[model samples]
Target: MMLETAFTPFYSLAGGALIGLAAVLLMLTTGRIMGATGILAGILQPTSLPDWSWRAVVLLGMISGPGAVLLITGQLPAVQVPVSTIMLVIGGFIVGVGVTFSSGCTSGHGVCGMARLSPRSIVATLTFMITTAITVYLIRHVIGV
Candidate 1:
């Protein structure tokens, strides 16, 4: 919790605001939804990319932000995964399935859809939140995993 007391609420809030701004700007500029799953899915398709340039640029921009910060500060965020590679892969697969079944990832429904007052998104977001809470409860409390 609190990244072991190293977390700063200021940075977290600012980071969230920046993400929201990026999502809004991307939508306004490109008329495309800014969902990571949707983007990845588009790239994975066999057909030629409709607008490969912007897709590559968006992906690169997302990557470069962290690289730029690392270069300037000579530090990366403290990240720790308390699971093995196999577990990580499994978790990722499960998340992909959920995204597919839900027709969108968290950002799609939680941020964009909710902002637009979509009823489907409202239900999807609520379902996702509740499921996440229950999973965490089981893992951390009951299962103690």
Candidate 2:
């Protein structure tokens, strides 16, 4: 099979800008890094009521994003999962493991951490990129899946 990628530069740029804006706003307001998994985990096992409140709002905002798109564009964004359910589950499990080992996910390290010139975040982001590239190569060429 052949691989094809849709080059949606404008959409990608807009999305990246929004993500950066959110990270900045969250940091300025709460002095906390906007790591998605960390936010969810915080909600699951909160330290305080105030901590849980902000995390809940962030998660709610994430869930309501599709509704925001619908209001603006008159339709919800189309989502396509190219991989099977089992593959998705396995990928999620692997990501969970990575987050546990790394202490943060891509949003925290790649966006917030790098923005703050954090050495650990820089290394973690580099590792994430290298691992991602190798995984894609193996999947597309070796496994041909």
Candidate 3:
């Protein structure tokens, strides 16, 4: 069966390109790798003023990026988070633990690390994709979410 989906290819491609550009820009600007988990962890740990300063700035920029888009476009595409609050919290905890266990998050492995041609990142990204597929299948099909 042909899957005729309502996917906006333009926005998806643009967003992907932007993410790649941002990753490259971060590398060129600062020699540090642009890994969100690493950035947040670094912020949590004791470090010199300059070291954490950049992390804080990057994290804040990430947080504000959507707001900037909303201001420019005057609307954000509809996004419905279907999970309940308790499930959301639990999922967050699971993600946190996974990041810690994996030593990086999706941005780190899937985007930046893949750009850098790291084997571990390739493996991590594959694992993430597979696990996500399984989880989504279980939630939507099996459990009938």
Candidate 4:
């Protein structure tokens, strides 16, 4: 939970401001929150064929923006995770399925929806958080994984 010195308080504030701005802008422009998983799921729907070019661009930026920043700065921090590649892929797939079933991702429900005080979003976000906490506890303690 601790940010490195390279990620100063100013950087953290700026990043948060950018996220807030992006979410606000997206809501104002498209009546949609900037949630990656929801957008990705929307792209996957076969019936949604009314110019998803913007969605594609947003997704591409989500994927490449960090890399672009690293390229510009010539310095990228290493990400350390204990899980294997297969576990990571499986986890991602499970998360995608969960988000689809829940009708929104954490960013959508937990951030934007909560800001608007949506009851369904509050329930969904709480459920997601509780489930995640229990799963982590079971994995780290019961299963020792």
Candidate 5:
């Protein structure tokens, strides 16, 4: 079994707090849930649409925040994934497609949806979890990828 690092608990708690804060702020201020996937998809919509710029900004911050922190602190965590660039791109594309078809990504369905007690979000979240579990099992055990 893989053991967590010494900083794991602190990092997990900090991450959870940040997520909770973002969710609360978004709901209170914009009356919308803070879901990165949904925010990113909104940016891809028409430029003439209202509220697209803020969504884009939010997505940008979401992408850049960790990088900025790592840059400032000079302590970026190591990534353990051994997949090739091609496989990474393919995996990302598949995830994008899956999120699109499922109507929301895990964060949207699992976090915000569960908070709101939406039945559809509950089902979608379960589907995401189950699919992820199966895929990981296949990659690590069956295919040994």
Candidate 6:
């Protein structure tokens, strides 16, 4: 099958700008890193009610984008999963392990950390990019999946 890549340059740029703004706002308001995994983890076992509340709010806001789209456009945005459920589960497990080992997710390292010129975040972000490239090559070209 041909890989269908949607080149939505304007949408991508707007989405990226919004994400950057959210990261900046989170840092400015809470002095917290905008790592999705970290936020989820905090909600799972938050140290305090306020911590849990903010994490929950962040998670809700992340999910509510689709609802907002539905309200404005009369439908949710199209989402396509290019892999099987098993593959998705395995990929999620691998990502969980990577996050645990790396101590931060892409939003933390790639967006915030690199923006701050953090050495560890720089290395982590590079590793993430290289691994992502290799993974896509293997999946699409080598495995033809």
Each model's total of backbone clashes: 0, 0, 0, 0, 0, 0
Over the stretch 1-145, how does candidate 1's per-residue lDDT look in tens digits? 1124466899889888987898899989998878777777666662565576677778889878877878978988657776569868988999989998887877788888888899998999999899989977877778776
Q: What C-alpha lDDT do the candidate models reach, one value each? A: 0.80, 0.90, 0.86, 0.79, 0.81, 0.90
lDDT of 4 by residue, 8-91 (tens): 798779777887788898889888888777777767773455537668877887778679769978876457677678878998
Q: How close to the true structure is residue 52 of candidate 4, measured as C-alpha lDDT?
A: 73
Off by over 4 Å in 4: 1-13, 46-50
Which lDDT tens digits does candidate 6 get at residues 76-95?
A: 89888778899889999999
- For candidate 5, the per-residue lDDT at 64 reads 83
Cα RMSD (angstroms) for every candidate in the order listed? 2.3, 1.5, 3.2, 3.4, 2.7, 1.4
- The lowest-lDDT stretch of 10 consecutive residues in candidate 4 is 1-10
- Structure candidate 3, residue pairs in collision: none
Enumerate residue pairs that collide in model 6. none
Candidate 2 worst ten-residue window by lDDT: 1-10
TM-score of 4: 0.81
Model 6 RMSD in Å is 1.4
**Ranking of all candidate structures by their TM-score, best first:** 2, 6, 3, 1, 5, 4
lDDT tens digits by residue: candidate 5, 13-35: 98888888898998998898788
Query: lDDT of model 3 at residue 21?
Result: 85
Q: Which stretches of model 6 miss by more than 4 angstroms? A: none
User: Which ranking of candidates, highest lDDT first?
Assistant: 6, 2, 3, 5, 1, 4
Clashes of 3: 0
Q: Give the per-residue Cα lDDT of candidate 3 at 73.
A: 96
CA lDDT, candidate 5, residue 21:
85
Which lDDT value does model 4 have at 84? 70
Off by over 4 Å in 1: 1-7
